[model samples]
Target: MRKDRMILRTPLPDRLCHWAMVVCFFLVALSGLSWLFPSLNWLNGVFGTPQMARVLHPFFGIVVFAALVYLFIRFVKYNLFEKEDRIWLENVKSVTAGDHSKPLRIGKYNAGQKFMFWGIMGLICVLLISGLVIWRAYFAHLFPIPVLRVALLLHAVAGVGLMLLIIGHIYLAFWVKGSIRGMVTGYVSHAWARAHHDRWHDQISGKGADKTKPGSAR
Candidate 1:
């Protein structure tokens, strides 16, 4: 693990925000789920007491939203779709089988990662809007009961959806050998980047490889 061979993958601010948001998200999610499920009611103890959980859940949710907004601004450019993404999508089976023979021309983030990025961003925005609408201590009174009811429904749905996306994210992060290490240490081995994101590796290393022509599915 020579330091010289590692490439900066995640910056310090983004890593800090990401882990901090993970903590806040779990706390808020567990507390909210406690209310939604009779058997999971004990989860409200996440904030020490059920009453305190109710008081702090909204605040924690706001923190998660803020962290995500910061991440979105920082990473959205890298996560945008590109022509090469179609190749990656088409070779989805090969990716899952750990076969990298195809010149997928993957950049900093692959098509699957790009999809997850947008999914997380879109779901978080939904959660924020609905959370604000149903925030009992502050905004709920501003809206009619009907609107509040609808907001509560949408908030719950968005929360579960975001949690599902996050579960998939966690799974893939661990499944990819160097991904979690990159997030934690802000770096990845050159070989890992070259194997997983060849185009990005080429761009950063100035390898001068020809770009994959558009519509070249192979």
Candidate 2:
């Protein structure tokens, strides 16, 4: 697509951060699972050696948390809920069926996307705190055995929850034809923007005025 005809959906820095986080998250998740289940023990070899995986897992998890923090700062405005979000929520069944006959008045993100954004942010926060408490190399000694055990349980639950959310996110990205491309190239065709995010497209193209300011729905 021509540059002039495409809209910027993600900026270069944000795209880079997202992809980098994905890589680190994969490593961290595999190592975490390896430790959680004996059948998945070999998965730790993703870091070259099981011993290395143990040493690097927490560091990689930290990197993932930092990257998510950066993304939250950059994209939170666009993901915030607005009154029109109820329209998308109310018609989610039709939206999921690939029907766009009506104007959903979606912002840069739809209600579903906002849910994902907050879900991820919330899970990562849990993971970070729990991981820190259970981190054997550093802070584990600072906590009582009971506290450490509780932190370990929370960490495991949050990790599994985050992985599930990411899987859903990946599924939806592929379900929406141009979503991955927009993330990779930082642009989406005007038609794509219009179909998926009419309100955002209108705000960007000046076709209609919105109650909220540009680049945000709230």
Candidate 3:
């Protein structure tokens, strides 16, 4: 059955930031593709060419990195690790088996989502720092060759990690019902929240609601 009502939630700035992050990452991904292989050289057309991608990849990374920095500054506190997060982690089986009844109650972001948040943060940090070590013609010259080489390796690993993380993030978001809408519309149906991210819905709406009993509709 489809839901009759939903709610407005995420702030305008947050929605904008989320989309900007997604868009910037796509641009970065495209530019990075140009660098991944000579056969994929045509991918550089988005930015210009291989040489152009060389110049643009780091620039694009800066944009994505900056946007993420803004998001991090805004939500890092809310996403901090907590005791409930541990319980949520321990009960992963229940969460995965479609048995949330006995699972730990959560807040804004669930344990899985929070873990991904941190993973994204870690990837961002690694990418930025490593991208810098080899971002020559200006800064790379300052670092030792050996250090730069190590940075090169780290940069590659971070790139792969980011790709996998993004794929996993999108899969899970789409996997869960009503999740995509919350991201796109910034709101979700009251019932949708109760079913998937109840704690977050409650935290946003005020307090938890009785799932077994009918209540005022939004």
Best by TM-score: 2
Q: Is 1 or 3 the stronger prediction by lDDT? A: 1
lDDT of 1 by residue, 125-211 (tens): 889999999988888899999998899899989988988888999999999999999999888888898789988887777565333
Clashing pairs in 1: none
Every model's Cα RMSD, please? Answer: 4.6, 2.3, 4.8
| CA RMSD (A), model 2 | 2.3
Q: Give the total clashing residue pairs for model 3.
A: 1
The residue-by-residue lDDT of candidate 3 on 1-218, one tens digit each, is 23335555465687798898798798788777667777876888776656777787888898889989888987776687767777788888878787767636666677888889999999989999999889986789999889999998898889889989999999988888877887787767876767666666666565554443222111
Of 2 and 3, the candidate ahead on TM-score is 2
TM-score of predicted model 1?
Answer: 0.93
The TM-score that candidate 2 achieves is 0.95
For candidate 1, which ten residues in a row score worst on lDDT? 209-218
- What pairs collide in candidate 2? none
Top-scoring candidate (lDDT): 2
Model 1, which residues run further than 4 Å from truth? 208-218
Model 2 misplacement above 4 A: 208-218
lDDT to native, each model: 0.87, 0.90, 0.76
